[model samples]
Target: MKVKQKSICETCRKQKIPCDGTKPSCSQCRLRDLCCPGYQSDWIFVPHTAQSDRHSGATVVSQSGIVGGRKRIKDPRPNPKYQGARELTVPRVLGLSVSHLMTLIIRSYVPEPELASLDSNSNGANTYSQPRICGCWVEVLPNLIAKGETVALSSAVRAFAVSILSGGPMPIASLASGLEAYSVALRSLQRALRSACQFRDELAAAIMCILLAELLLPTTLNSWAAHLQGFGELMQLSGPELYTSGIGHKLFVGARPSLVILGFLSRKASFLGTDEWRCLPFGLQPPSAMQQLLSEAAVIPSILERLDKASGLPPRDRAIVDRESLHDFVAVLGRLGQWETYLQSADQYPLSWVKADAEEGAISCRWFNNITDANVLTHFWAFKVICLQNIDELAGNHPGMTSSSQFSTSFRERVGLSVMISQSIGYLMQDEMKLFGPSSVIMPLRTAYDTFRAGSSQCKVELRQCNEIISGILERGYHFVPLFFEAFRDAQFCPMSV
Candidate 1:
């Protein structure tokens, strides 16, 4: 017969106690304490066989609990809520990984003296930290301002380096791809990317785009590398400094010309003009006024006429005019009798070319010296007047009441246009400056500033309308993040797109 073996209580085996083995704890320990000693820390004990957990070599977890009996092991199964988490990894760029390329970029850009932050954070302590934007780990906006208070040259260089290492070079139409990659790469390292995502985030875009634009500009330059770097520099300025208020108009701000050109290029790329220009309906094309004039109730007739003709077309087909179309239209009138000359060579055209010539003309008596072209100025005014009229009377907001006469009418808008006409017309009279300059022919400013001015009639009527557009953009921006982390959580793997 087999030798009789004593029952080994799990509690006694776990606690190293002498056991007159019973069902749960040792009969001695339980009777004396009225509780099994190790059973109080039941999470640590494997039940059933007294020796079951001994061979596994896994440490037990102890939770505070009082147990009197040998309850079965409390094995709970995992639910769907706890399953299938995505693995985040450092994004790879080109052939090299993000970590490696960033090392290369930091190494290259750090060599510049104007860029001093390069060496200060050089210690391996915080070697690869990305700037905080907004929220949690996701996204890169080329806008730049969202990432930090000020754009530092070193950081700008680092971001550009990452963008280039990842995306190579991008056309103006698809610049966001590289930024997305930088966002992903940054998200996975040490910390999740985002402490703030706001209007400020545009700084990141501005910095990256400026760097990226530094690479793509100057079409005539045959050096591909030079072209790429040039475009990137322009993109970097899309930040609050250049893109913000009155300060953006400074001469030779570098990006001003390219942004003007980009507005043009983006306009050309959109088969349907959205932000830059509106189109006349095929059936109801406006021969008298290309765009509707301003009004309170009066302007509605023309707009309605245009809208009626356009309304029959699907909502998708309705053309909303924008900045580019206005500029292009201005260009058309500027070309005057020579309009065809510009059409074939729009791509080779940079705003700088036009501005440069205008400046030279003003400085030296050269092309377009005649200030007698009233027709060109008037046409320019017409485009602007119509643009202003469109800006007026958008009742998107209820900004209380005002005088009835204040209700903008096209005739009144023409009156408002007269204010701009006065301001711009005087520009041509500024010494011999216009003998060859841009502002010579009644001037070519990319503004309907008078129409938007607070004192102007259209601005009063359209203030709420403009604010609604601004607010709408803000509200829409809030949805940048998705509910499912998996959707953008994968950005860590592919930095080019978050």
Candidate 2:
């Protein structure tokens, strides 16, 4: 019996993906300059050739890696900086007597492969260095001028929201508890915003900014005379601290745009339910998952109440009309949906053990314990979008807010603004203020915008930088932060490179 010729490896046959085929080196292997498995009956192809010619190209021909006559010829590209990491350490902030700037601590963790694969020549270069101290720093956000020494010793009432969301290692309960811890800052920011709401135009803007300073100052590292005795402690607490900077520390205030952007982010964040899940794919999706997700926002009785009052909308489609309302409702639904699904069946992604251990009690078959990795990032990005929209609106000064009816107005109040504000402030907190409560998360944005009417250049820059950072992180998780750190440092310190 005569047997026909065997098929080539998919990678080699297509060349679109990696493949090895032929001779001692098949056509695919030869193309990649590898010792192909050679006519081996079992079409097994190693992903890459050991002797890779990828970087072996001579003078700029194949700058990355060149293949020549079964050899990986070393490319003669000049090494931009020798000693790899060490050489890259020269403070980009070289000569200028730059202030220490703001006291917020931002330490970036760079992801490899994705971040490393990027061209170092561009703003997307790879480097995950921790935050370094630079002599020159600038704080443009101003302190609110006050007389008589802010001596109001009023008894401050607090909102203590205890979230029993936690069931186990997924730590929903713990996170909820931690979130309540931040009520202190949230309440203060809220009070400031509400207080400013009672004030007139210019003063409102100023006071609104002063409250923004609570979040923004910590983010931008700005402080002043009212910051308390001595400089050392102030400098020490400068990074991400409210109302203070450290000794001989360089403090910087975020400009108007930065403040506005924070508000926008908060607005975006509000759309992502505190306990919801959202999945993002490249194409169209069945509406069931979406419908299921939208139902979760029912936890926020207010949105559901407004959605009900806007009674004319078809029951099924009611949650889908306005972006903010739709987003929040869906977000809440997805979270609840995820929990329900986890109880039914657990997915293999997120490297979770829900499948094996659910019956064993390591984690529950309940809602909070079944959180997926995909869900976490999904909510993260969703919030970013809401924030971005606000950023865009604020950047352009969204003046045409007039709607044909009161529905849009109600929608904005119920869900829109909250989502936008959360996104902005979320980005601003790259440090200790990491975990957040659903309500507290959206405070900065609402507070800032309810007070300030316009965006400033500083606010814009920070927003752009932050959005880029968030985008990077969403795409590549932790690694993206480092690249941003390098780009940010290079720009803020050296600047010429950016």
**TM-score, per-candidate, Cα-based:** 0.21, 0.21
Candidate 1 local accuracy as lDDT?
A: 0.30
Q: Candidate 2, overall lDDT?
A: 0.28
Q: Write the per-residue lDDT of candidate 2 for residues 126-199, one digit (tens) a residue.
A: 22121111101111111211111121101010111111111110111233222332333345544654554232
Off by over 4 Å in 2: 1-80, 84-346, 349-498
Q: Please, what are the lDDT tens digits per residue for candidate 1 over residues 1-498?
A: 864334555556666657764322346764677555322222333332436535543221111111112222111111234243221111212223323333333332221221233334332112112111110001122112223324232334344443433333211112343453333333321131133333233333334333342232221212323433344343343432333322121111222222222322222221112221222111132211111211111222233334445546654454342222333433433443243243226435321111233342122211222232222343345444544444343221212322345445644665554444433333333332211122122112222333444444545543333233223322322111111112222433212222
**Against the true structure, what is every candidate's RMSD?**
26.7, 27.2
Instruction: Locate the minimum summed-lDDT window of 10 residues in model 1.
Output: 130-139
Cα error, candidate 1, residue 374 (Å): 29
Q: What lDDT does the true structure give each of the candidates?
A: 0.30, 0.28
